[model samples]
Target: MTRIVLALAQELAAIVAVGFAQRDEEVHQADPATVAAADLSGVDVLVVRSEPRVLNAALVAACDRAGVRIVPYATDAAGHRLAASFGLALLTTLEAEHIVHHTVPPHREPVCGGVIVVWGPHGAPGRSTLAASLAAECARGNRPTALIDADSHAPALAMMLGLTDDGPGFASACRAAERRTLDAAELSRVAQPLRATDGACSVLTGINRPGRWPELSAERVTACLEIARGWVETIVIDVAASLEEDGEILSDMASPARNAATIAALRSADHIVAVASADAVGIARFIRAYGELRALVGDTPVHVVVNRVRTASLGLDAKGQIRRTLARFTNVEEILFLSHEPDIADGAALHSRTITDIAPKSAFAAGVRRLAADVLGQPDTAATAMPRRARRGRKNKPAIADVAGVPAQLG
Candidate 1:
């Protein structure tokens, strides 16, 4: 009897997870040639990992010759094309993580909850700044929040916030998948608590090492977000810029990390903060990047943040000009302009401190506060308007404040 042979690359084993094994009739580890031979005999399906570092086409075609369906777990665009060409169902992280690992029941079973991803189109567009600030703000409002650093190639959120040696980040999460122990609860164990100096609710900071890229796959990313959503009321993602390069090195839009992180976070986002610089080049890139992001994200709420805007320069006011320009091309209705606060920028870029803490009175700090108000859907309020403190100092039960001007309250 020819049995279905499932050959998984070592790394892909963790990525596709063991749930696939349960879904299949028979699962085994074998070289590509062996799978092809089995397929020729009578194997029904060949589940393989399209990890280029290990598996290749010769192995893929071997299965094809056997008239067996080749199911590959892959993430790149190329993988999708290859799977489509071979009439194989591509196992993406989107469905794989959710189906394979189920620890707690789905929190938002019928209705998905809120996920806020902070993304920047190429360049150093203050994505990190906005992400950190938003997380802090949400937690301060007594809303449970989880901050995820999905920038696989350049994972730096841990270092930026001084979170150290807690548990596995993306890479460690991958290993959990390999052991078949990677679940929502396991992820919570590895998460590092990042609380502001003011003792607000903390955000989870992931691993900071580039050597741990393998841990931050699309599957684990989804898992982390899933668990975070259930535990926290809001999830903030600090995404990297896109990876693709331009000819003659003309200019790069968004960081490679941003694109990868954005795609990975799409299924989870209730809101997205698209960060951009205020300069002409930044604006141009934002216009283009916005279109691409919308195409990928559909009609999700996108709040635009124009960072480092100098009031004196560019003739017209920075905020007004950005809104008018964006309106001309994109359908984004909400735009938040943050004045250029050089003092805070110096501290953040060099010292790694939030503007609210360092230059609490600077324009940049005020902008961040205003942005926070907008995020909560409240009218801009004075800085003295602090988050209500708990009477008995209970960490879980925080006094909630309504953002006065925001049209609606986020659940």
Candidate 2:
């Protein structure tokens, strides 16, 4: 009689038993956690149930190096993370769920969807706020939106939305992508649902730590975004600020992982929201970065958001100065101006309430609402009378989509 270890219990156990029974292998039942902990020096096939088991990366790596196949019947986020770490492929469960194993399947078609990337230049430019706000706004409008925090370094979306300690973030998602085990259900399991008090919006927070960047890559980023697009109407990606500044781990150009994640996100974006500080230096950075971003993502629609705008600094309207500078250097016709609202900083600092919720009547909120409308394809019904030629391929092409208070559009 051939001996086989069985870790999953109940219906899963019966199903595994029958499968081995057909193959004439003797089955030995054991706790799934025990299988993960048991020494497999002489074991042929080790099966473990997918549950609150701590299957570290080192153990999975050791199994691979020693030719021991670790079969994880993981239906949850932890199992998927383990399987991907070990380069294992998942097998289908009797209950119609997919778990991680150690093989590759046939090529399948990728899901069709759109990506909304909220990227920022160096410095705190509020990319997280934009990503969260847009996602929540879309959800509020009854459009399903999946918010992905792709900022591998210094992740802030989870904390911003009060989703820390929820579950695995981008790391788990990437691991699943590496193992070819990523699917809608697995993605949903790992993704913490951002409960909408006003409506239905789904948000998947990013990894909270900067040390776990290795687990997520550009390929995984692409796969996760792809999965999100299929599961929702829009994907709001909150990614790290570009590496224009030195000394940032995620922006370290030398790091292939960092480069891959950032480049992949830029390439995959259907529409991009380029965030910049509202100060003179920030505006200058955006002017320079816009050229580089354009080169990275050719012909993709980009919206420039000048965050934290304050006229008191320049003693005159700083927006005019920034606009003049942008118009002179780049053909970018539109720039959205968001004012400095102390309430926003207070909300984030004291309470975790989103700027949209706490300061809905604030100037910053109003600006973001206009920007959101533009993103959602809502016409500016509040705009004053204007010429209507509807000229094709002109800078004015974006005029129909541009918000009134927002700056000029990028041609």
Top candidate (lDDT): 2
Q: What C-alpha RMSD separates each model from the true structure?
A: 12.3, 10.6
lDDT values for all models: 0.57, 0.62
**Model 1 lDDT tens row, 1-411:** 224444765565454445554563344556643453453555655566544322334455565576665556678654553344334455765244432332222242222225778887776777877787667766665565667777755656777766673556655654565444554466567666665645354445555665555455555565455434434556778766663322225455332232343476764577778887878888889888877777777877777777766545566655567767887888655666666645445666466555455555554555556666656566767435544552233344312221122111010
- The list of candidate 1 runs beyond 4 A from truth reads 1-113, 165-167, 174-185, 201-203, 243-260, 311-313, 348-351, 373-411
**Cα lDDT tens digits for candidate 2, 1-411:** 434566666576777676554454556666654454566555545566433232434345555665666566656554553344334554436321122124443443222225778887777777887677667666665666688878877678777777774478667877886675676677778777775546556666666567777666776776666555445666778777664323355556655565556667888787889988867777777777888888889987888877766676655857677677778987766887776656455664466556666555454555666666667676643233332432232344334232224222110
For candidate 2, which ten residues in a row score worst on lDDT?
402-411
Candidate 2 backbone collisions, by pair:
89-101, 333-408, 333-409, 334-408, 334-409, 335-407, 335-408
Clash count for each candidate, listed in order shown: 21, 7
How much does candidate 2 score in TM-score? 0.63
